[model samples]
Target: MTFEQHISGNIEYLERPGSIGGPVLVMLHGIGSNAASFTPLLDHLPRDWRVIAWNAPGYGGSIPLDAEWPLALDYAAALKDFLDRLELKRVLLAGHSLGCLIGAAYAAAHRERVVRLLLSSPALGHGVPCGGALSAAAQARIDDLQTLGPDGFAALRAPRLVFEPESNPEIVRYVRDGMARVSLPGYPKAARMLASGRLIDDAERLQVPTDVIVGAHDVVTPPDSARRAHAALRHPWRGAFTLVPGAGHALYQQAPVAFAAALAALAETVG
Candidate 1:
């Protein structure tokens, strides 16, 4: 099934409508990615379910937040606005990488609105306080973007996001292309959010069923980090942590079938 891209209010999203009154799945991408990052995973998803992936604030045609360094809650507020604009009361929220931080904040703040939560290759932010000095890792990302530009930065970093670029050239190229499209304001803002975010704090407050998935070979956010995030979950889904072997940070793209299976498993549990 093909996804139709559209702008709802200030948010741009890709949607594939399924059966009327069918289950809804909403996806949030990582800092370097936009909604298109979820396209591959969406194709493998159930045809009877509705899926929507949003370009977080500052990406695509979505408006940037007013704050120079927006917090996870700020992004959560933007997410709330996007969902409200779509008239969606409840949804199964799936977040990847940096998106996990935002999703955790949203789910914790509005637990009633999220039916289930799935976090992939979760990035546990550096926990730097707002207005404080950024971590060396976070500063390096910002420095790379500024020094290398989008294309150069993407070329240099995208390869590391996947486990084996030689084996998954197409997926690597896809990820590289997505990263290359990340522009200013949004990219920098997301970096700052990462510097300040501590996903575990929000994860600990979550009352909804949650699951964590990570690439065993992921270098960006390794399985150990994913396990830590899973351990912090207040209500872990089936008390499980999924490890996608031979995949990396971009697990959804590198292993879409496994990612889809995870979503299918979540649906089964809820139904």
Candidate 2:
């Protein structure tokens, strides 16, 4: 595995190179997590499949957006540039939580580059009650983070990310550590994007194969949310809403085996 700066030195990504001619999987971590969050998932995937997990702008050592509070499209533009720099013409894009929103935006604008998309524990922005409600909710998260700080905020919310946090000490640590790594300067902007993102609209515009997978027990973005997002897809029949039993919002971490299996299934269907 290697971490290198790409896209004219604006983006930093963790990569696991595969054999020549093997398919590529570009993984995007959620708001509070970095590319390392997909470490376990990478371990479970086929060794021959190349994997690239990006530390989205504002997280880890990656650069932050120039805007005070950028929109989802802003993030999408960065992702597109990253892909272009890597010379990846087509790829299997998998995103988690906030990454889902950004991925949807990219797929909508650059349909030809994305052959397949997998949204794991997606955070459906517009799927919330109303625009006002979403904004208010997003503001609340920003407020909490600003007040509590990263360590405090992680302490308060990390446990809620997984089911039976008491029984899963390792996962709890993983969640907390990932959240603690979030950049204070970048998080507020990401929260604003999350609250006001047009993920549903973007999903509806997607022309390639898509899948929404959520942990049945996920409270942050529940099964109902995933179903709604799946229903909004332009090709609902071609897409699917899969529920990983007994898992929670941290589905990828809690059930890496099952989550990887789901991803492999999608890859098999890709042309």
RMSD of 1: 1.2
How do the residues 134-227 of candidate 2 rate in per-residue lDDT, one tens digit apiece? 4767878888898998899898889999999999989999999999887678898788788777677887888878988999899998889888
Cα lDDT tens digits, model 1, 1-271, are 6689999988889999989978899999999999988888767888999999999999999999989989999999999998999999989999999999999999999988998889889999999999999999989999999999999999999999999898889989999999999998889999999999999888888888889999999999989999989998763442468999989999999999999988876675463
Q: Which stretches of candidate 1 lie over 4 Å from their true place?
A: 235-238
Per-candidate TM-scores read: 0.97, 0.93
> What is candidate 2's CA lDDT for residue 113?
84
Task: Output the lDDT of residue 183, model 1.
Answer: 91
Residue 3 of model 1: what lDDT? 82
- The lDDT values for all models are 0.90, 0.84
The RMSD of every model to the true structure, in order and in angstroms, is: 1.2, 2.4
Residue 175 in candidate 1, Cα distance off native in Å: 0.7
